[model samples]
Target: MSLIYVLDILGTFAFAISGALVASDKKFDLFGVLIIAFVTAVGGGMLRDVLINAHPINWIGDLNYLFVIFTAVVFTFLFKSKIAHLSKTMFLFDTVGISVFTLLGLEKGLSYDLHPIIALIMGMISAVFGGVLRDVLTNKIPLIFQKEIYASACLAGGITYLILNHFHIPENIIFIISASIIIIIRVIAVKFELELPKIKDDLFTKK
Candidate 1:
């Protein structure tokens, strides 16, 4: 199997765990947890595929993808209590979730002969849309709207990938560098409580 495929699976697994954690936190039952995990794992990729006209989509034909989601959901649910420790050490599952997906989405776009700008948008969408969907379903403010440098990290990763690609970097190396960039940015943002500036509603308030 190619590294990209592995990264894609990892992204799906991480995202599934993230979703399962959220659902579990919300007191969702097993079925609801599984549903959230599956959708959060595949939703962004599905959107990206549709936009890029990737016929049949990625998970539609692959039973393994479902298997991965199922495994992730089960494991995450079983180990929910212990996962807090994991997050304390490595980047949070949500952060890892976005990092890998951003690279895969950008690569997929490049494979489709898309422009770099569009590819960057695809990367951001692929990284964050699933989380947004999950948050919306759970009645929480989505991370992107909360101004914590979520989607911006994805964008930065995509830009990094494009720059490396422009310099004729190898694919595997490019993936590592770009993915690391996103993860580091997310880690620092969360660690330092960094957030992008929000526009004031007063700007549009009627006098």
Candidate 2:
């Protein structure tokens, strides 16, 4: 498989695991866990496809995606204790997944001749929308809305990918560098508990 394809598969697997982990924490049944895994794995891609008119969607064209998600769910089921205890490890995997997926989304948008701004937005959505849905369904606040450096990291990476591609950098190197930037920023932000400023509830008055 191509490097891009490998990264895509890895990202899907990581996302599936994240979803399964959350579902397990909520005491969801096996079917519910699998549903969360499947949805988290492909939700963003499906949205991107719909918006871009990439009909039939990506998972439809590739059963391997489904296989990967199923495998992730199985792995999570068999090793819930070990995996559940590794919150930092899970975060690391999630960082990698979002970074890689963001680049993939940006590349797809560019390929479709979409504007760069739209491409960047799609990239952010591709990385975080699934997580948002996962959190909402699980009755937790979405990470992106919690002042953490979540979606912003994806946005930074997506924009960096576009800039590098604009300058004609080697595709593989560009992908690696852009993803690294994202992962680094996320790790640093999490490690230091860095958060973006939130709008204070009293900052605005009724007109």
Candidate 3:
């Protein structure tokens, strides 16, 4: 299989695991856990496809995606205690998922003849919207809306991909470098508690 396809599956798996863990923490039952896992694994890609008018969606046609998500849920259930004990387990899986999803979605948009800028937006959406949906469903704030460097990392990675592609970089190398940029940026941002500046305190005050 192609490296891109493998990365896509891996991202899906990671997202599914993360979702399952969150659902478990929320005391969701089996059905709720499965639903959350499914949404977290494919919600972003589905939104991206619909925005681009891609027919059939992705997981709808590809049973492999479903299989990967199912496997992830099972794995999460089997190792719930052990995985939960690791302080950075969710962070690690989430970082991997977003990094891979950003590049894959960006490349998909480019293949559809989208402008590079629009494709970068698509990349950001694909990387973060799944988590957005998950957080919304779980009654928590979405990370993208928070001050943390979430979608920005995806945008940075997408820009890196575009710049490398402009120079005719090898596809495999570009994928690795671009995804690594997203992962590294996310890691550094979280490690140092870096966040975007908040809105002015008086912006919403009475005139």
Predicted model with the maximum TM-score? 2
Report the lDDT tens digits of candidate 2 across residue range 139-177.
Answer: 888867987798778888888898999899989899999
Candidate structures ordered by TM-score, highest first: 2, 3, 1
Estimate candidate 2's alpha-carbon lDDT, on a 0 to 1 scale. 0.87
In angstroms, the error of model 3 at 52 is 0.4
Superposed Cα deviation of residue 115, candidate 1 (Å)? 1.9
lDDT of 1 by residue, 103-204 (tens): 888888889999989988888878888888889888898867977888888888889999999999888898888888998998888789898886766677
Taking all chains together, each candidate's TM-score versus the true structure is 0.88, 0.91, 0.90
What are the C-alpha RMSDs, in order, of all predicted structures? 2.8, 2.6, 2.7
CA lDDT of each prediction against the hidden true structure:
0.84, 0.87, 0.87
Residue-level lDDT for 29 in candidate 3: 95
* Tens digit per residue, CA lDDT, model 3, 37-113: 99999999899999998778888878998999889888888888887676486677678889889988899899999
- Candidate 2: list runs displaced more than 4 Å: 201-207
Give the distance in Å from residue 201's predicted Cα in candidate 2 to where it truly belongs.
7.6
Residue pairs with backbone overlap in model 1: none
